[model samples]
Target: MSDTYAARAWLAAADPDPAHAELWLTYTGVALMPLGTNWSAVRVQERQGLRVASLNGPAIHDGPARAVYFLVPTEADWPGGMGELLGGPSCWLGVPAPERVEPPGIYWLTPPDGSGLLVDPVALLAALCEDGADR
Candidate 1:
């Protein structure tokens, strides 16, 4: 499962000063990965798309979907602290994976800009954190 997740993003502090605990945590993962962006501060875009299957209880798999977006800042917030979010649908954020082991489509929060937050897949069953914990 871990090996199934190859693509990733790693965010880091714009400055060299002591970064916030939260910021450091983000950089630890998102700062060292490749991404696609024209004008932005920092973001976590889904490269492998998403999987929405009612049979599997709606999961985030390494497959393709109809619509793929981002969790950018609003128009007014664009190029600002948060860098105006445009796509990266929030539904894929904390889907029993990202934010936490909840379930299919459910996003309750969106952190700040220049922050590190993305999604991946664990094909192997044994690698799942909340395997039988659901049933």
Candidate 2:
């Protein structure tokens, strides 16, 4: 799939480190659920020199589609703080499910607490930022 303007800008925002952009655009959708707001009113903002894309959509209730994609800015980056902030399980980006694992290459989030709104990772993440997240 060709990259959209937003995708390009998003990647550029990542600047010297485009890894997150790559993951977001290639493997998983990235939804930036900003602080002080519900998932419904997600808004994009620049944080620490990164373009945060906030996405929204109906949650997908299925075994393989109940995950969100997030880019770890650094190898040390994880969802511990974000999860604690959200007062729920920390949503750390986990390894991509094996091809043998049904969906194949679908990014997985960690903790697997199994009790949150079932959201479409692709829509939730891709729906943000001018539809660049979609393919």
Candidate 3:
């Protein structure tokens, strides 16, 4: 199987550290899940300074595809804040956005509980690196 989108990387010196990036991705994905039920994983690589990408489409349900790609400048820099977003209370009650898009799927930074959004860029890049090695 092949994909419609094809992004590539050129690896060399000055690449981001893979160990730190992978740990951050794994930690954040687990931490970011609502109710500690984050059903996701993280992967990282070094091509352009801590790059991340997702290889699979999110489990979509009942609506349009909801996940969006974002350039997280702090992806390699975010602390363990993903858990805070999931475990903490909202600034307001009955916020509609998170609730609406949750089931559809999304990739969000600091997204709310059951938001049905995820961040898998690091995972994507990890897969790419693996595929590159396989090739």
- Top model number, TM-score: 2
- Candidate 1 C-alpha lDDT tens digits along 12-98: 222223244234334432221111231121221233122112112112322232222332222213332221133322211211113
**TM-score of every candidate:** 0.18, 0.22, 0.20
Error of 3 at 121 (Å): 1.8
RMSD of each: 14.6, 15.0, 17.4
- The lDDT for every candidate, in the order shown, is 0.25, 0.29, 0.27
Candidate 3 structure quality by residue, lDDT tens digits, 1-135 = 111111101100012343443343344321122211223222122232122223233321212322233222122333332211222232211111222334323323223322233445555455445666665
User: What alpha-carbon RMSD in Å does predicted model 1 have with respect to the real structure?
Assistant: 14.6
- Clash numbers, per candidate: 17, 4, 9
